[model samples]
Target chain A: MTDETMLEEDGHSGGVVKKFLYVNRRAPYGSIYALESLEVVLIGAAFEQDVSLLFLDDGVFQLKKGQDTAMTDMKNFSPTYRALEMYDVEKLYADRESIEQRGLTEDDLIVPVEVLSRDEIKDLMAQQDVVLSF
Target chain B: MKFSVLVNEGPYQHEASDSAYHFTKAALEKGHEIFRVFFYHDGVNNGTRLATPPQDDRNITQRWSALAEQHNLDLVVCVAAAQRRGIIDADEMKRHGKDANNIAPGFRISGLGQLIEAGIQADRLITFGD
Candidate 1:
């Protein structure tokens, strides 16, 4: 379908704002995927799209507090998670199983996030127009 | 059908790029319209023209360029991801005061908005990654 027709069919011919869900499955610092995904989320917030972030697997560690990269020579960007609220991108979901597996509680994170079960997260993922994983 | 593809891995190192390429080609062969291909993370490396693979093997960058040229596809490399990985276009090179640029043909540098836009505009947004 053409772009115009797709927008028109959605009844938002003026502009279609899609639901974008970013799935974070990697740990921070080990690779650049986690940090780069955040960059996309931050930039995507500017578009005024319906955006949600999901933390699964080792991605739960990204929200953990007191992340020190002093010896790694990489800038610790964990503080940026707090600023997500200012961007109006507040829907942060952390998998309960992942947290429990890693022996972490909600109190350990730098910012507050909704802890959901795998099934609940699956339902949320189904509702998204786009699911981008990193 | 309209399709939007996302590639998250670099060339040679992973099969994500190759898989995305084949999927896109197959979709096009079946008369599907490609809304855009957003290269994120190491996938941005696919947009560099400096890759010099051996002559015997498939040149992934050239394959993408050729497909884009044949189909007039929109290949977008995320600016934020590209900058961190040293993949810059002429404008970004000037803005960042870099010595040169290596962005491949048929690929443009843009923000994450293009990706969101693609998801909105396309009927399907398929991602190939680890």
Candidate 2:
């Protein structure tokens, strides 16, 4: 895309890259929130906004490794988390307290995630232009 | 301030839809610009015209339609979510070979990109859901 094309589109649709934080607070399965949230992340990536994913509570389980769903009907979607890097969704965070409470270490997760304290999470939330919860 | 609202639950089954409606109305009352209301997940159920609640109870869907009509508000239902939940407009009903369309007036079925656009265009993006 050239500057001429950008200016043409900007005449009607003016947009600036905004910080969009998608806060996930649920387990991966038993509900559709986890899956649908991922779908939104993939779709929203097309907009080229600054995006981040924060996992707290049961949402941390979404990144849990060695997920075996062969017996159940649910698909093992943990692999998709690894693919998020391809979409430039590189910023992933988790609450340290929540992870510790669940007795899961950073190594237990499938992907590399920055662990932050509760206060740090609050500050991070304040920094976001939009905080979408699921 | 310009605001965009995201409703992610059903009309009567959850408070999310009602809360979103009231918040939008309140914002409009205070002379704020509502950029759009993007309904997702079960929230698409709020756009159905087939809902007939008890006469004494508040008509959640109608309230939204009236508010949109009054303010010329853009009430966008996520096309993917709506299709999955059986909330179809005329275009979708025709394309999918459905018997009828149940989308209420003032509500349009569109893509999820509209929600992202709302987030970009609006000064604030608020999500009212579980």
Candidate 3:
């Protein structure tokens, strides 16, 4: 790396673990936001922060099973959600309203997520040191 | 109040970048410390020097370049995001065999770890996007 790049790499938290939340609000395949956001989560997993992934609004569809992107021609990235556990990113939450409004049951989602009420989601966000939404 | 700003959109397609620029300017004017300004996704386009908008309109890329100059800001474009958008730097051009790097002044391309570090160090990590 050049000296200029090194200037930005200076100073990392030695052991202070901040609660970092990645909130996905866009659906998969509609736009690149969901896929790109997941890339951030995976890249950031190395930092070992208290990371969490919350799927709300259209983002809830990202975890739905049977996502065949062959027709859409976009890469099927839905399966990557399952591999997040391997990276030690275990905290996954889903907004209850968004799921129900879309007529999706708990079993409809591919990955297991703690269905959170509106107030619960607010409380979860309030506790986070940093919250990033897509 | 130390802040790290995240810009998630491109220069002109969305108001996110414009709002982020104004907010960053206002924050610096208020004498607040800015840890970093991260550009991700299409936000990486804000760091491209080749963007030529109309003469009358505000040149968003130059605005950020000027802001970084004035504030000595650490303006970082995510390496992964930039690569996807073809926003190559001089070093990247050599490494990737890309001709003609188009990165704007005062912006350095780096990893997402910088974003993580910003969250850890800054008082607040503010995100501007749709």
Tell me how far the alpha carbon of residue B58 in candidate 3 is from the true structure, in angstroms, after superposition.
1.0
DockQ for all models:
0.36, 0.41, 0.49
Which lDDT values do the candidates have, in the order given? 0.87, 0.89, 0.90
> Would candidate 2 be rated incorrect, acceptable, medium or high by CAPRI criteria?
acceptable
Error of 3 at B79 (Å): 1.1
Which model scores highest in TM-score?
3
- Stretches of candidate 1 exceeding 4 Å from the true structure: A1-14
TM-score of each: 0.91, 0.91, 0.93
Best by DockQ: 3
What value does the lDDT take at residue A125 in candidate 2?
97
* Runs with alpha carbons beyond 4 Å of true place in candidate 3: A1-12
B60-108: candidate 2 lDDT, tens digit per residue:
9999999999999999998877877899999887887899999999999
Whole-model alpha-carbon lDDT for candidate 1: 0.87
Error of 3 at B91 (Å): 1.5
What are the RMSD figures for all models against the true structure?
5.5, 4.6, 3.3
Superposed by TM-score, candidate 3 places the C-alpha of residue A52 at a distance from the truth, in angstroms, of 1.3
